[model samples]
Target: MFTGIIEAMGTLTELRRQGEDVVLTVEAPGLDFSDVKLGDSIATNGVCLTVIALGDKRYSADVSLETLARTGFAQAKVGDRMNLEKALTPSSRLGGHLVSGHVDGMGQVMSRRSSGRAIEYWIKAPADLSRYIAEKGSIAVDGISLTVNAVKGDAFLLTIVPHTAEETTIARWKPGHRVNLEVDQIARYLERLLQGGAGAQAPSSTLTLAKLAQSGFL
Candidate 1:
């Protein structure tokens, strides 16, 4: 699990094609490699990849064909900058929402503008993914957790604060660039289980969970 709060940005030093999979060599000096072991999960641009080898600052991981097919990583090139975040620790603060580091789909930046002290961007996500988009809802784009400001058909607008823009790789993004997107997993699951589900009835059309609990049935 992850918080979607990117710790640092890393650069792909090299990419080597090995059969259907490819090995990625990335350099992230600030990324603590001591606790990382082979097979440990790390989010690279919202895609969960395992650590295949650990070095002083550079590490290598193999990207499976399935992962490549599902994410924009397939077109990743050498020297590409990626948002990086290690798996969450129990003691770590939940600065962002629960992120499985799983990319659901890709979104394209359509337009950009400068807000007061932020950057406002319009991203066009896939049509199927728009079902998960909602105003004030959480979404992970390019590994950075952000809140959706407004929702339009097949697209949404996001305003990234200056701090976030600077700390994450969003500052480096350009219009038409493809970004990995992961919608709020909980919302998606609930929407599915509540509507058109096998036996899920309406999602408790009554009051609230607290009210129900206070009334004795949890």
Candidate 2:
């Protein structure tokens, strides 16, 4: 697990394809590598990647085909900056919400505007994932934890402060740019519980205004 708090910014130094999988070399001199070891997990742009090889200030990991199909890494290139975070330890402070580093779906930047010292961005989430997003909810975009300022049909708003832009890759996002999105883990679990857990069949009808009224929930 991860706290979704970005510890350092890394650059994709090399990308080598090996059969169906690809190997990535990331260089993050700013990252503290003193305690990192082989087999450790690192959250790279919201995707949990196992460290296959370690070096002075770099590490390499193999990206499976499943990951490439689901993350922005499909379009990633050398020199691209990535948000990096080490897995949280038991003693680590919960600075951000619990992040599984599992990208649920990809989102696209819909619009961008300046909001005083902060930048306001609207990103369109995948249609199927919209139900998991709520106003004031927590979300991880490209591995950076952020609060949802507001929510529309299939899009959500975020207010990125200067520090966040400087610390991570949010500043580089533009309209139509794709980003890895991981919704709140709690929300996902709650949904499974609501569905009766595990392999239980889904409800025949979704909760709606009329159903809420009938159930005395309105």
Candidate 3:
């Protein structure tokens, strides 16, 4: 798991295609891989990729075709900058929300405007993904966890402060730029639990104090 807090930015140094999959070598000069062993997981732009080879300032990983199809990496190229984060340790602070490093879908930046020292951006997510997003909820955009300031249709708004803009790749975002998006993990599981399965009936009415008292649960 991760915290969606970007530790550094890494550059895609090289990509080699092998059948339907590809091998990627990233130049992560800011990351110290001294203790990282083979098969360690790393979050590259919110996608959990296993480290196949560890070097002083570089590491290689294999990206599957499914991952490429679901993430913005389908159009990624060498020299592209990627947000990087190491797996969370037990002692690590939960600075950001829990991130699984699993991209739910791709989102496009619809608009951007300057709001004093902050920048407001509107991102349009996939139609199906819109249901999982909620106002004031947490969402990871391009691997940066941000709170949704508002939600309209299939799009959401975010306010990025100067510190966040400078620490990550959001500074390079534009109106048409595409980014990897990961919705809150809790929301997805809650939906599944509530939906249950066939023949299972969800609560017919909303849970309230009066209803709870009537049901003798309060």
Which candidate leads in TM-score?
2
Instruction: Estimate, for each residue in 54-159, the C-alpha lDDT of model 2 and write its tens digit.
Output: 9889999999999999998889999999999999999999998999999999999999999999999999999999999989999999999999999999999999
Candidate 3 regions with alpha-carbon error over 4 angstroms:
198-218
TM-score of structure candidate 1: 0.89
Q: Which tens-of-lDDT digit does each residue in 128-200 have in candidate 1?
A: 8998888899999988889999998998999989889888889887899999999999877766644546475
lDDT of 1 at 165: 86
- What C-alpha lDDT does candidate 3 achieve relative to the native structure? 0.90
Candidate 3 steric clashes:
0
| Candidate order (TM-score) | 2, 3, 1
Q: Compared with the true structure, what per-residue lDDT tens digits does model 3 show for residues 1-218? A: 99999998999999999898999999999887776889888999999999998776999999999999999888999999999998988899999999999999999999999999999999999998999899989999888889999999999999999999998989899999999999998878756655553276655645455664697733
* Candidate 1 residue pairs in clash (backbone atoms < 3 Å): none
The positional error of residue 12 in candidate 1, measured at the CA in angstroms, is: 0.2
Off by over 4 Å in 2: 198-218
